[model samples]
Target: MDVCTLGDLIDVVGSPALRLHTASAGTGSPVTEVLLYDAHAPLPHAPGALLLAVGVRAAEAGPLVRAAAEAGMTGVVVRGTDGPAAEAEAHGVALLTVGEDTAWHHVHLMLAAAVDARSAQGAGLGDLFALADAIAAATGGATAVEDPRQRILAYSTVPGQPVDEDRRQGILGLQVPGSVDNSEQVRQVFAAPAPVRLPPLTAADLPRLACAVRAGGEPLGSIWVVDTGTLAPDAEQTLAQGVSTAALLLLRRRAAQELTRHQNADLLRRLLDGAADAATAAHRLGWNAVRVAAFALDSAAGVPDAERTSLRLLDLVRLQCDARYGRHACVLLDGVVYALLPAPEASGGAGGPEARTTADRRHRQLAEDIVGRAGPSLRVPVRAALGAVVSCRDGVTASRADADAVLRLLDDALPVAAVDEIRPRVTLLRLADVMRERGELRAGAWQRVLDADAEYGTEYARTLTAWFGTGCDVASAARQLSVHPNTCRYRLKQIGAQLGIDLDDADERLVLWLQLRVLAEPDAPA
Candidate 1:
C-alpha cells in the first residue's frame, strides 16, 4: 500500500489537501491504518490502508479523525465543501480546501505544485495573487489576494479579473460574496489593521469565494486567501504552504521602505484639526503642563550645529516619548526642547499613555538629562526645564518658562549646557507672577512672601541668598564670601528683621526654600 505525509501529498497533487484517516471497523475495534488515497475521486483505500465511510450528516468530527489518528494513518483527506468536512474537523482533523467544484488530480500532483511555489523567487505578492486567481478559476473556486504586508498592493479574482478601485476603495461596506461566514467573517478581517486570518471562516469552509491584499509582517499586516465554500480535502494544506512565502515577500517590501519613514503622526494631528499644517493650529488646541520623558538620536551627527542637533533630538525624543508619556506638540526656539504633556480633564481619561500616570519628578529629570547628553554629542550645550502639572493652556505657559530657564543657563556654562541646570524655581516664580496677576493667588495672599516688596530688595536678597547657599552653615557662608561667620549670621538676622519674616515657621521655611532655589538660577546673585 502507498502512504504519504501532509507535506508530501501537496507536492504530488498539484492542488491543496488535508490528510485524514479512519478505522475500518466498528467502534473500539482495533483497525490498523495506512495512507496514499486518491483524494480527488474518493476511491477505495489501497489494500493496506484502513477505510471508514460515513453519511454526510454526522456533525461530530473528533471520533472519526481520532480513530484514524490512533490507527497509525499518516493523515486524513476530505472534501471541504460538504458537511463531512466540518464533521472531520470536529473530530480534530485539519481540513484543507482543494477546490469548490471537483478535485482535478491525485495527491501526487498537488504536492509538486506546493514545492515549486516555495522554491521559486521573483514570485512575489503580485505573482501569488495572480496564482490564486488562476488556480481558483481553473479549479472552480473564488477570488484571491496574497498580501503579507498591509500595503494592499495587489489582488486578483478568477483568471483575468482583478479588483478595481471602485470595489476595493469601497470595501468597507461590501460583504464577502463567499458561501462561508460572509458578514461576520468579512467584518473581523477588516477590523484588524494588520494582516491576519479571515474570521467567521471555519474548517468546512470551501473556496466558493476569495479575497486578499499584500502587507508586511512584524506586526503582521498582510493578507492571503483560499477562496471558496467547497474545496477538496487538501485545500487548507495549500494555504498553509503559501503563507510563509507570502509573509516573507511582504516583510521585504516594508523593510525597504523603513528608510523613508518620518513621523507623519503630526500630520494626522493637523488633519484632525481641519488644517494640514498642524503646528499653526496647535495654538488652538488645549496644551497641558504634565511631565514628559524623551530621548533623542540623529540621522547623522558629524559637524552638527548645536541648535540643529537639539531640534533633531527633539524629534527622536518625541517618537519614543510617544510610547511612554504620550503625544505633545514640539516647539524649539533657539536651542531648547519645549513640549506639552496633556492632563486629563477627569479620571479614566482618553489621552495618551502619559495621561495614565500623574506628574512624576523622575520623568522630568530624565528628559532633561537625555537632552543634556545630546548637547555634548552635538558639541552644543543643552539645558532643559520642566514645570509642575498644571491645567490646560498652562502647559503652553510652562513651556515658555522652561525655555527661558534653558536659555538663561546656556550662556553661563562651558559654551554647552546640560539639563540639570533647569531651575523649577524659575517656573514657580513665573507661575506665582501669573497667578497673582490673574487673582488666583488669593488662595494664599498674605502668606506669600512672593508679593513682598522688601523681598525683591537687592542687598537683603544677596545676604539671604549667600546664607542659604551655605546650607544654613554660617562658617561656610562666611568662608565662601571671605567674610567673618558672625557677619554672615548678622546679615541673615538683619534681613529677617527687615523682611519681618520668621525664619523658623513652616510657612516661612517654604518661602525661604523658594527664594533660595531662585537664587541658584544662572546669573542670579550667590
Candidate 2:
C-alpha cells in the first residue's frame, strides 16, 4: 500500500470531511456498490456501494473520509476525536465517530496504494479507455473518457448517439448522476492541465453515462472518476486527476494508429479525385497500374445511420485486397466503398477487346468477393450496388453516377445481397441503357432546364415545361398540364418564343419532360 492509514494519505492529498466508509473486515469494499449524495433515495438507505467502519482513529478519520469520497462512499465511521465533528459538520458531510479498531491501518494503506497504483502502471490513452470501463464495471459506478477536444472518443455506458470517429471530440449525451451537469460541464470544470473537480453526472443519469477520459499534462483525453455517491473534496479530485492523467497517456499512443489509417484513406481519395497526376498517384499508391470501382451499400430501409456501418463492411473489401491484390486504401464515402485494385502496366493496355475482357474478368471477381462477404451486422443485412469504371476523370464521374444507379436499383429491384452486387459496368450501364430506352437525356436535358429555372423561378419554369411537353395542343396539353387551356397555350407560345424553341418539336418536348423530373429531385437521374 502507498501509506498506512487515511491519516498518512492526508499529507499527499488533503483530508475530506463528507465521505465515510465502514470496513469492519478491511476488504475495502464500501457498504454498497451505489451511493447518491444529497439524494432523496428511500430512507433507511443502507449504503450498498460503501461501508463505514467504527474503529478508524480520529486523526485517520480525515483521510478515511477522503478515501470514502474518492471511492464513492456516502459516510464513514471513525473513533471520536477532537476535530472530527467540526470538520465533518463544516464540509456539510454526514459524519460518524466510533471507537478504535485495528483494521484501520492496513485498509488506509491499501487505499493510498490504490491511488498510487494507477500511475505506477503506466498506460497510453487508448488503454485508458478500456481501463475506464474496467473501473466502472468493478466499482459499479459510471466512467467516461474524452479526447483533447473534449469530444468523447469513447466511454463506458455511452449515450445512445455517441460519436466514435474522433478520440478528441466532446462526449455528447453523457448524463452523469450527481450534482455534476452534462458532459460539457464536466469537461469545463476539470479541463485544466492539472486534475480537478470534473463536474460529474447525477446518480440517476450516471447509470447510463458512466464514462472515462485520458488527460495528462496536456491531456489527450479524459478518464472518468465516478462513484455512486458524492466524493470528498480532496480524494475526489486526486483520484480523478491521477486516473485522468493515465488515460491521456494511453490515448496518445492510439492516436498514431488512427492517424496513419486516415492519412492513407486521404491520399487514396486524392488519387481517385483526378486532381493529381495519375502516374505519380499510381506510384505513390504502390500501383504500377490500377483499376478502380465504386460500390454503394445501403442499410435496409428504416435502419439508422447505415453509413456508419461502412467501417465494418469496408473490412470485407480489405479482406479481398489482402487475399488477392494486396494492401491498399479502402475508403467509405456516402455509403460506398470506393475501392482500387492494383495491377501491372503490362496488364493494363491494348485499350480494347483484350482490355474489356480483362476488366470484365476482374470485375466479376470483385463482384463475387463483395457479394460473398456482405452479411448482417448489428442485426441488419447490408445491401450494395456497384458501377463500371471509366478510364480516368470520366471513369470517376461514371462510377459515381453508376454507384448511385445501383443504389436506385436496390431501391427498385433485386434484394441483391448488398450494394456491391450492382456491378458498375453492368448495373450502372444497364441503368444508362434503360434511360436511353426510356428516351431520356437525363444529364443533358436536366442541365438545360436547371439553367432555365435558375433564371425563371419555379412557377414560370413549371408553366413553360408543361406547355412544351403537350405539343401546343391547348386542350389536350392543358388537361395533362393541369392548367386552363388558354393559360397553357399562352404560356407555351410566350415561353417558346422567349427560349427560341418550337412549341411543337419532339426534341423540345423530351427536354421539357426531362427538365421537370430533374428539377424536381436535383440530385437524381431524370
Candidate 3:
C-alpha cells in the first residue's frame, strides 16, 4: 500500500479549498488521521495527524501550529494566509490555508476521501488521477473523469495544459458549475455508442470529446477531454478504448461500496430489532454518542417504479446523513429507509434537561431537509418520521417503533413529523395494532353492520360510522351521510333494535366506536 503523504493529500484535494502555504520538513509525512482543532479542548498526541483549525483566527493560530509540531502532526489547515507560517516552519511542520468560501465539513470530506483511498490502496482501487493523466497524455489535451451526476472525480494537472475557465472551475469545485447548461450534452453522450464531439457551451468554454463509461449496459460515468485541434488523429479512438478500463474500475469501486453498505445495513437491522448487543454494536459501528434517534423515510403511495425510487431515496438519505453527522447508520427494510442519527452530544455535553428536545429539533430539521430534497431531485413525494431521542443504544428499538408508527400514520399533508408531535395519533395506532392482533372486530356489532350492508345492500354501516364520527348528533350525522335528520334517527333506532344494544350506554358507545375505527383500517380483515 502506498503511504498517503501530506503532499499527496494536497495534490488529491486541489486548490480553491486547500493550498500549501508553507513547506517544511514534515511535508512528506504520512497522514494517518484528520482532527478538528479546538482551543479549549486538550489536544491529544496523534502522530501524522492533519489538523483543521476551523473557526480559529489566523493571528491566534501560533499555539496550534506549535502544538501540532510538538504532537508530531503533519500540518494545520487554516482559513487565512495570515497564519503563523514562520512558527510552523521553525517547528518543522507544514501550514496550509483553506478558501474563505469552503466549509469545514467539505474539507473534512475531501481529506477523508484522500486518506481512505490511500488505506484501501492494496485493494486494487484504480487511481483516477493517473488515468486522467494517461488519457491526457494520449490525447494531448487536458482531461476530466466525471460521474453520471456531473461530479468531477479526477482531472489532469499537468502544467502548461490548455484548459478553459469551465474546466478550471469544475476541478476546483469537484462538480460541473451550475451555470453551465449541459443537460443536452450529457444526454447525447450517454445515448451515443461512440465518442461524441460536444460544442462549447459558451465562448469561455472549450470544445470537448466525451464517452460514457458503461458496465453491463448500465452507464457508470463519463470521460471528457479538451479538444484544442492539437490532438492525435486517433484521440477519439483512444478515448473510446479508455472507457473499457474506466468501466472496470468503476464497477470494482461500486462493488466494494455496496459490500460495505450491506454490512452496515445488516448490523443496523439487528440493532433496531434488538437482536444484537447494543454496546458492542455501537462500538463496532463507531457511533460514540450519549443519545440517538431513529428516522423512518418512505415514498408516498402509487409512485411510478416504486422499488427504484425507494433505492434512490435510500442512497440520498445515506449520503445526507453521512455528510452531516460524519458517523451514522442507515438501512433499507421493507421499502422504507431507516437512519440512526446521533445527537449533538460529543464529549457527553448533551446531559442537560433539554437535551432530548434539542436533539429532536435537530433531527427533525434533517428529516425535513431530506424530504424536501427528494421531491425536486427524485420527482417523487417523500415523507419522514422522527422517533424520540433515547439515552442509549438499547432504547433505539423503541425509537424505531415510534418512527415506524408515525410513518404508517403519515398522510399527504404531513411530509415530516416527530413521534412526540403526534403522540395521540401514535397511541391510537398502537391500540389499533392490539385490536388487530386480538381480532376484536371479527364478531362484534361492527361485523354485524358489515354483514347487513353486504346482505341487504344497506348503508347501515356507513350511517353508523358517520353517526359516531359526528358525536351522535343526528343533524350532523345526517349532513355527513347526505340524508335528512329523520332518516339518520330512523337508522339509529333500527340499529339498536336489530342488535339488541342501547345507543345511550356510554361504555358500549366507546367500545363500538373503537371497533368501527379499527374496521375502517385499510388492512382490516374481511
lDDT of 2 by residue, 130-232 (tens): 6656545544444565554444444655332222212213344432222334546555644544444433243333222222343334445555444435434
- Pitting candidate 1 against candidate 2, the one with the higher lDDT is 2
C-alpha local distance difference test of each model? 0.42, 0.48, 0.77
Off by over 4 Å in 3: 1-126, 179-181, 232-234, 277-337, 341-343, 346-383, 389-395, 405-415, 422-526
The most accurate candidate by lDDT is 3
Q: Weakest 10 consecutive residues, lDDT, candidate 2?
A: 1-10
> What's the C-alpha lDDT at position 165 in model 1?
33
Predicted structure 1: lDDT: 0.42
Put down candidate 3 lDDT per residue, 97-142, tens digits, no spaces.
Answer: 9877778898888787777665555353347777888899999989
Name the lDDT value of residue 279 in candidate 1. Answer: 30
Which residue runs of candidate 2 sit more than 4 Å off their true CA positions? 1-264, 273-277, 286-289, 304-308, 343-352, 377-409, 412-503, 516-526
Residue-wise C-alpha lDDT for candidate 1, range 323-375, written one tens digit per residue:
45533455443344555555454244566447544434445545555556566
In candidate 3, the residue pairs with backbone N, CA or C atoms under 3 Å apart (3 or more residues apart, or in different chains) clash, namely none
> What is the model-wide C-alpha lDDT for candidate 3?
0.77
Report lDDT (Cα) of residue 85, candidate 3. 88
All candidates: TM-score: 0.33, 0.33, 0.48
